[model samples]
Target: MHTTALVLFSGGQDSTTCLAQALSKYERVETLGFDYGQRHHIEMDTRRVVLANLRERFPQWAPHMGEDHVLTLAALQQLGGSSLTDEVAFAMQADGLPNTFVPGRNLLFLTLAGALAYRRGLQVIVTGVCETDFSGYPDCRDDTMKAMQIALSLGLERRLLIETPLMWIDKADTWALAHSLGGQALVDLIIEDTHTCYLGDRVHRNAWGYGCGTCPACELRQRGWARYSARDANASSSP
Candidate 1:
């Protein structure tokens, strides 16, 4: 059984929720992020903000929250065909994946996280890669995570579990999970602090969060918020 975790936190909704989930389950939890030369670099800032908020507001999780590490991978921008790293429009490719799909992004993140975990003496790696309501990113799939887990364990010569709490859930369910973990406070933090825009637009704030509302990331968040809020409202009104 894994008692300690290193969460791949991007300072986004899914990642923040994953951090909460890990803190709830593990005895100790650390966070890791990557500065992958994304056009939307605000995540690097928002991630820290989110971590600070969690530590301050949630006393139960404060002690377990440990050191946070960030890595800069300049190579992604150098090899970029994706809109996330380059000055390009978002569109689907002939291969059926979105232009926003950064090739080998999750894979590389996990590999590096594994190395960091080894150095830091962590037991498991947690990420918030969901597939049930995602934009068809192969790296976010269940099979890909499973394969990566096996590879990391074998390469490290030690058993390391890869935990994906959001893998089987959709966006609305993700919202519900956040509520369960940290209640309305966490939901408010996600809405006010987490950054998920592909364009990194922070000036315009929406009901869900800050982002270019039309971007795939924002669209999913907005849609999920609509469903979650509607359901919560109905539940509250029920006798």
Candidate 2:
């Protein structure tokens, strides 16, 4: 039987890397993106662009890059506590979690992904939720993912492998993994095209995709790029 996988893609740097990894491993890979009424709704457009580029640049993987399914969760906007989904200003709490953290967003996304996977008879569901370097979102924790996996399995009555490729790795390691999967070209695609900014500002380009440069998401990405660049420079200079 051909192995099929569903990726919970957000069209961000980490999720894009997860997509690359999925394409490398699975025979058939379908992407699931959410239109959860985020302030950065531009991510949906970015996801489409990335998928198109993948098909155009790597025709060999085109067959594996199955459908890109986008689900609209407009209710998230109505709930309206998160800066990402609401008109509120983005701010980080004393604990480091920004207001951009949508409540139960990942949980809802994973549950929906589980339902899709169960109906499609897929055994694996890939996500880009990283514990390290993540902005204090409880849903992104490894423990949370494990618990969700158990709950999802019980709820669906089907065993599903929740793959978190970026769970343990930081953003810099994520960049290295993306490079290993498809080399510098993939890396460039992610840096230049993927949208990670909370502010949804794509006009200002930086080392790490377009962003306002002050949001937590952009800060983490920029720091990761700096670390990755330094490591690359050191490796090149070494005897």
Candidate 3:
């Protein structure tokens, strides 16, 4: 029997890529999405829609894959300092941390994911956090994830493998992986349908992907899209 794994899903580019990666590796894979009082529910809604589509494509993906287990981290509202769960108006800092950084976000999410894994006898929890994309956010760093892994192991009293397949890869590589896993069809759907805008605006996005292009999230995404496009252009032109 293949070992079951749980994914820390968010229905965005990174997490969606991670989810697709999980689909390829594990015999059974369940997704864990949190309703942490976000400013908007578009991301969660996107998760539902994407998973539903995936189910149609891969019927064997999740009946025993915990289709009913999309957990909610509602308590994140109580522990808010970032703009995600707070009403505080955030100004775009030119150099320092952006207001989009949610304190203790990955930490809390990973802990809950670990507990869920332990309870369900699943040993792997996969997330798509990247140090290169969102380096401004301290939580996205490799050190932060390592620390959380240790903490979760101690708390759960069991060995758990927290998979970070996209941690070291950049957005361009992520797009490449998406293409490899689910083909250009899935990759196109992810690009056109997924939501990653920090301001929660998808309808008003440019060619670089969704989100307010001025925010840090959009900046990274837009740059990556450009880089990927250029790389593809060069590759096609090469002998």
Candidate 4:
């Protein structure tokens, strides 16, 4: 039986890395991207381009790269308090939780992914939610993922494995993981093509993906790239 996995891809650095890792491990890999009425809806465009690039560059994995699914949850915008779904400006620190923290976003995404996985007879679902170096999103934690896994399994009446490859790893480690999975090609794809910017400004390209350079997501990515580059430089200088 061929091992099949579904990836909850967002076309950002972390999810893109998770997708690459899935292609490396799974016999058949399908990706699901959400259109939750986010301000940075260009992420879907990036996802398409990334998938196309992967299929072209890594033809060996092309057979396993199953069809990609894009689901729209536009109602989340109607039910919005989050800066991501609302017209509110993105703010890093506002009160206890960040304004960008879309309530139940990850939960809904994972649940939907699980439903799709169960329907397709897939037992493994990969997500890129990271606890380490994460913003104040509560759903990105390991406990939440575990609980969601159990809920999905019980609800679907099928044992489901939720794979969080970037769960404990920080952004710098995420970069290293991408490099390990697909070498410089993957790394370059992430840097040059993937969209991680919350503001969706493709004009301000950097070592990291195109970002506005001020949002929390961009800050974390920039910091991670700086750390990763420094480490690489030091290693190159070493014996």
How do the predictions measure up, each by TM-score?
0.98, 0.96, 0.89, 0.96
**Mind giving the per-residue lDDT tens digits that candidate 4 earns over 96-154?**
78889988889999989998998887879999998889886899999999999899989
What lDDT tens digits, residue by residue, belong to model 2 across residues 1-239? Answer: 43899999888999889999889889999989999888998998988888889888777678898877888898889888788887777788667778888888999999999998887777899999988888789999999999999999898888888999999988889999999998998999998879999889999988777999998889999999999999999999999
Per-residue lDDT of candidate 3, residues 108-222 (tens digit): 8888889888888887889988877665778888898888888888887888888889887898888888888888777776877787876788778577556778766677788
Question: Which candidate leads the pack in TM-score?
Answer: 1
Give the distance in Å from residue 11's predicted Cα in candidate 1 to where it truly belongs: 0.1
* RMSD (CA, angstroms), candidate 4: 1.4
Give per-residue lDDT, candidate 3, residue 194. 80
lDDT agreement with native, every candidate: 0.94, 0.89, 0.79, 0.89
Worst 10 residues of 4 by lDDT: 86-95
Cα lDDT over the full model 3: 0.79
lDDT of 3 at 152: 87
- Steric clash count of candidate 2: 0
Stretches of candidate 1 off by over 4 Å are none
